[model samples]
Target chain A: MDTHDAKKPLPRLTPDNRAFWEGCREHKILLPWCQYCDRPHWPPGPVCPYCFGDDLTWKQSSGRGVISSWVVVHKAWLPAFAADIPYNAVQVELEEGIRLTGNVVGASNKTLRVGLPVEVVFDDVTPEATLPRFKPR
Target chain B: MRDDVAIVGIGQSEFGRYLPISQLGLGAKALQAALTDAQLERKDIDGLSLHMGWPLGADYDRMAEVYGLEVDYVHQSWTHGRFVTSSLQHAVMAVACGMAEVVACITAISFTRELSILGGPGDPEGMREQGATHGENPVYGLTSPAVGAAFALQRYMALYGATSAQLAAVPIALRKHALLSPYAVMKQPLTLEDHQSSRMVVDPLHLFDCSLITDGAAVVLLTSAERARSMPNVPVYVAGMQGVRSGRSEFIFAPPGLGINQQPASPTTPRERDLAVYGRAGIGREAIQGFYTYDAFSPLVLFALERFGFCGPGEGASWVQGGRIELGGELPVNTSGGLLSEAHVCGWNSICEMVRQLRGMAGPRQIAGAEALQWGTCWGDSVIMRR
Candidate 1:
């Protein structure tokens, strides 16, 4: 197993969201599917935002989305990302109708555009976490 | 509630970095100055309304205790420019309801240690039991408010063909105004070329487009119109004021679900809450002579210009192209250099400028024959002051 020092901020694994992180380790994208509303959402929460129902479950994602908007960070505010200056942070709208935030790995700042088609590519940055990244499809 | 409340005194601390003093010290200095300016002592103040953005280590009760003044009425709004006007409204209502005779509205921000208002690793809201998320963006490398604002700017440019030159003019004009302002932090004059050639913190936004992070505080003294008339400074009446929070729940960086589309569907459209502020004040758009919009980012100026009906949507870039927003222009905007060059104390700096313009105390930067001055945040907080 290959791991690096936790230089950047990392997500803590919790009971309600452990499945999503665990699934990421296996190269599977997971989102919360509410039993009450039958709708999936991102940045998993305790209950359905719309219905507020406790009946919720995990669902696999289709792994496709569009670039709703994006920004190229030329300056790094944190020491961890100093080496990665000039990276792209993008807002991706999944085919499942959920919007997730990630960076597009294979695109330049000049090339990125709104509504650009993108597909998810998981990066096993550390042994404990796998970061989701996007690339032009 | 309209003609009943008037701002009689205004005070501000030096807006650059002040070390060894917490936000409390800065706020107390401004409050004391305001009390003296109003020709009243701390004991005369019975109401306190404060807008101190989050990570606030103290509250209204704490401030009252520190000053040894007992305020009969108190209200607080936490986090950013949107709350400053809301805090002012609370003071107006407090005086109208007889809760307090003299109310003081204070706002302050300290970045001496170089604190970032944008979510950081220390943010409680950014922390989760499983992992830390960067506010709504939730991305590894992107952590500043500029990132979210850049996305909106890109959409605006795509839709209206607004160019960088048009956006650069906003900062350039404001910087020129700052030269005349003795309290301004950025004393150097700025040009359109300097704005265009500056480093890009985020795409479609330059380093100059963002605001100055400094340690400063501003205070406004509000009282009944009858009492204000006796004060030393001329009374600037609060003619019409209103605040509206967006009901849209979907995050800006997040995509809406299939049935749920991202609200405020157009990033640049003037919101209903904006129009309501004008209607509430019973003043038509043409009556406003001076203007100030929250300039946390430069593109926001364009959003506000159109939102307040100063110009049609997509015409803001051209509206400010000539010297229209300068001191001699028909309608002067941000005569105090605003957040870009003046110093960003949330909205306090702008509010103080509006007060000065209406009182004819702005000196060289003063807009002559100014009848009314209006100030608002991009998020819908608004206030109109009449001479």
Candidate 2:
């Protein structure tokens, strides 16, 4: 998993989401929090999605959550992932109450289930891109 | 605008796989058939409500120019199944408002030709700055739209203790209807065992659970109710309409509060707001003799039933069993096979089937005394048509 393949798709970086990606590169999970709403939102945007307020800040998360939903890809829709057939992708409900999509590492696809406790582990797949996967805690 | 506009004509080209015909070519055949069915000339069409566009189907402007349709009013949306109800709603609105004389809701697809875009690298939807609407995160190898449905269904089964065998009833019923449909791409009857043994594309979603990647086109014509009287076919009045819902609680592939994407975990039955289409249509859900939906995946049919209050949350899997949604069941859905067994004309095929059912023209798959039918999706948009 350490070998970086050019074939794997990378998340498109934008001005609004740059910090979250940058935080990931530093091995930390950052979430956008609104000062007015006093809560964090997902897929970070400039304005607070909850209150539509401009007062927003970044905060570190515990990188801990429970699996809310999960799926195993049996088809190689992407050729780069052909070797990883039957691989699992999951939606983890983070401690901050926002969900993020990632893979569950160091676990068998058969054992994955909803409400399973997991913590994030950064995978520095490429020199520039580090994806955050999860493992059973 | 209730009953002010009606679908006077419905037509479609032969549905199949890897057809050599171009998208525009298929569209022309369907358009010609629609014009002939309505006993109207090509020049009568003054508006175009296009649901399919670039990369999958012809653009509105290209369709207008190639088909020689000189229209004034036009509505176009991106190529997605969620837009089918909205696209037809736009046509009804255009005709009711006197914006156009007759609007043609055009949808033509060549999925076999554009196979790469479905989930392959050719699809850039997952790489969008905001993110793909259907939970497509290619970075995690969740590249296809089916994965989104799988994600929702996986959670749904976990929450409700549903099983794969219960979900198989969906494709099995639809395949039964396809056997009676001349236009359906799949002519064979499907069994629960066949569904169980089918290869898995995404976990909890067998290959049969997904829609056909075949090629086809369907065209529908709408005009004012006053003008419909002169048409050759029976007018299927656009009795009621509602738009697609969106918010923090709604997920594109899941019913409200099923907890997919960022949706909250509190699952509830259909609220009053969810049943607005029934009131708008001047009928209750009981009056809806037949049902239709964007069955891109088998799970959508279940979610739609739940979204429309046909059943409570987590009950769709069990509710659809025992010939419940079949042709002569409590409420038949997608009598013309739907996207699952019928060709994926982006759900427009079901729309055509609706018009046919209301007209008493659906030969074998017709619902007895069918008066009202619904075209709703899991996304919460709907259009109800009545005879």
Candidate 3:
């Protein structure tokens, strides 16, 4: 039996979210802004879900924020992340006021609390994707 | 809402990660069980509705085909946000509106696998691919569901003084009931010690506080009160139903509602999120003998109970102390075990439990004199009924 089929490799990229991928590629995190409310959404909506407005724009983000909350995973589920046994996976409330997730590279579990100070930086795991992550101030 | 619609049949299967069976097989099992309990035939169903997970959920045509159900109407519904009883409310409306003789609803999850929280990538081409298609949730390293549901949980704990134990209670209470329920995914009696010992998923929320990705399905059949009264099973009426969509914009805070920056609107003032639901058909909050809010995440449970008016805002943690939410407690919840221990069949099994309580067929775990089992089918809609 081929282990390739047994292990469902995760998705790389698709058309709908290509803009977000492209935004990340250029070293600028992007969010789909509602043309009506002038607000940005993380899981980009097809339409302005708030005002039912059809118009939307992709806006750049500062990629700066504080850690709202985090967890330290002692176990690894797959090959890609196993090397780093204990990592702080966090939900950072970005400066945009939108809560996006990232990993905390420089903190232990006890040090991570509900409202702690932090900032976002990029970790290029692959040649194409410059992933957003955070560290203590 | 009219007092004419009623639930005449209900069914549920064993819960857990059953990668071996397909979703269709679970649906079939539920169909057979419910049909037997109601003493009705598959040919009796006319109108239909089904709600479940992604990819497997987006395909309405496929569900109808696999079940061999020639439904007159159908709706698969949204995410965990969409409650199960909400579908029952619509089916009740269909029966009341003179649409058909009978309506049936089912959920199948035998093959619905879970994604690793470690940013295991995503399904891009599938219709259920949803919005965030392009990148890695892992590179920055925040990928687990505990962390996904953390901000809101933290906010709830901060505001209400809700402890990790209070959060753990939601799952432990359900695990107790699961021992009584053959269909429940967890059978082991989980103590507060067991609850505390479970590894932390996110800060504050331990693994036990989260819901299991179980394999199972549940179905409910409904018809006019007049028709249900004539059926072999006891009659339970559809009392009242209400559902609303807060423009995805209203809840700018994702998951459990945490704003990354300033909220799209002022966060101080409550914007119609509160009192969206009353507890019941008769006595309101005072009369709801049991509660069945979704417990996919413990903090979500706290927020749900508060938002739905079980307690005052930020008072959920305090009110659930010293076995208050346990099986024999005043406002007994998840008496049949909630999604945390019973498996999240997308809250379908919760609706089944409520209906069984009202019909007085919930053998061992049945609440005494439960005239109605008010349920939340979707966060958008709430269901309240009477005997």
* Candidate that scores best on lDDT: 2
User: Residue B122, candidate 2: how far off, in angstroms?
Assistant: 4.0
What is the Å distance of residue A57 in model 1 from its true position? 4.1
In terms of lDDT, which candidate is stronger, 1 or 2?
A: 2
Candidate 2: regions farther than 4 A off? none
Under CAPRI classification, how is model 1 graded?
acceptable
Encode model 3's per-residue lDDT on A19-88: one tens digit a residue. 8767776777888888779997666657765687868888888877777655565545434455555556
Winning model by DockQ: 2
- Order of the predicted models by TM-score, top scorer first: 2, 1, 3
Give the 10-residue window scoring lowest on summed lDDT in candidate 3 chain B.
B260-269
Better of 2 and 3 by TM-score: 2
Which CAPRI quality tier does the interface of model 3 achieve? acceptable
Misplaced by over 4 Å in model 1 are A1-5, A12-22, A34-38, A41-57, B18-20, B53-57, B114-125, B128-139, B249-273
User: By lDDT, highest first, what's the ranking?
Assistant: 2, 1, 3
Ranking by DockQ: 2, 1, 3
- Write model 1 residue lDDT over B1-387, tens digit each, in one string: 777899988888878866467787888888888888888888888888989745653588887787798888888887466576788899998988888999999886686554654645554444546333223343365566666667767756665687888888889888989998998999898988889899998887899998887778889999999998888888999888877445443332212111112443434445565578777777777888988877888877876777676877667778888888887886777999988999988878888889888888899998887778888665556788897
lDDT of 2 at B241: 91
Residue B80, model 3: lDDT of: 38
How many residue pairs clash in each candidate at the backbone level? 5, 0, 15
lDDT of 1: 0.76
Q: Could you give candidate 2's per-residue lDDT for residues B1-387 as a string of tens digits?
A: 889999998889989999999988998899889988998898999999998986567778888888888999999986798888889999988988889999999988899988866898846778877878898999888888999999999999999999999999999999999999999889888988999999999998999999999888889999999989887889999999999999889899999889998999998888888889999989899989999999999999999999999999999999999999998899999998999998899999999999999999899999999999999999999999999
